[model samples]
Target: MQRFQGSPRSVLSTLLLVLVMGLLLYPGLKNIAVYLFSAITGNYISGTHSVVFLSCPNEQVGKVIARTIVEKKLAACVSILPKVFSIYNWDSEITETTEVLMVLKTRTSKIHRLTEFISGSRVE
Candidate 1:
């Protein structure tokens, strides 16, 4: 009877210790996770915006698109990658060519205007 009672008490102590440790570490662990997620995800919130990928025929054309978006305050940022080779069919012919890729980080609301502006500025 004495041995049985001691074993139960030891098990209870171990469970209680685990519970206390969990309680103590939870807040710290949660904060660490939040920090890591924020660092990786760029502080996204519900109802925020998405970026648009706009391509231009050349660096000159891409720069024009980027400048217009920024000057109009339609975008927060525009990252341009030049000299990308694009392989596609145009006018019933397969074409392999180099072009500039502009990642236009604009709000969804300005997509229509941005598209119109980009379409009008095509230099091909």
Candidate 2:
């Protein structure tokens, strides 16, 4: 009891610790507004949004494209999942390669804007 600061069976102890921690950590959690909002409202978000997926040959290119979209606000967030195996036909050869997959989340209203941005940029 004296050494176990993280005892799983102490429900009251956990609650009290969590309450104190919340109060102490409130100011540091400003960036968590979206999560808190979703929890309180039981809604994903205010806007209608969708995710668009794109794959790049490597992590570096994937990161660059993802970063560019996010920086331009074309997407709310871009997740780069690496080491994905892809098989496809390019030119006259069948090719298999390891790639990075980017899942971009953005508002539905911004789809056209996002598309335009992607077209204007060299990523498409």
Candidate 3:
């Protein structure tokens, strides 16, 4: 094996190049960097957006709620996920049931209205 002949500056440059490549190639690191940049620049404001989760007894209920939310501009999007199994305690009893999960994405300012609408539109 020949003796290494690179200078300190060259070695550091190579190490930095590798680090930059890693940051570009790895998704997790890239996301962290982007998040930091956005945070520092005030481009990503916390509490500006909200994700609300609602459980529905069936797909029809989920669809109805989703549609109403979108139509009323309470949420920008509502994703209805079906066949979600839930086990929980209610009134001192364990209840197990399949439920539809609704994920609502909306502005934080609209969260209160969205929640009120959901409460008033409860299927039960």
Q: Lowest summed lDDT over 10 consecutive residues: which window, candidate 1?
A: 44-53
Off by over 4 Å in 2: 1-42, 45-47
Q: Residue 73 in candidate 2 has what lDDT? A: 91
**Cand. 2 TM to true fold:** 0.57
Candidate 3: C-alpha RMSD to true structure equals 11.3
Best by lDDT: 3
Residue pairs with backbone atoms closer than 3 Å in model 2 (clashes): none
lDDT for model 3 comes to 0.86
What Cα-based lDDT does every candidate model obtain? Answer: 0.78, 0.82, 0.86
TM-scores vs. true structure, each candidate: 0.58, 0.57, 0.63
* Model 2 lDDT per residue over 26-52, tens place: 865853775577668877775456889
| Residue 89 CA displacement from its true place in model 3, Å | 0.7
Worst 10 residues of 2 by lDDT: 30-39
lDDT of 1 by residue, 1-124 (tens): 3555468889999899999999999988976676567559888543345778776788987887788779988788999998998999999999999998888776565788777876676554
- Top-TM-score structure, candidate number: 3
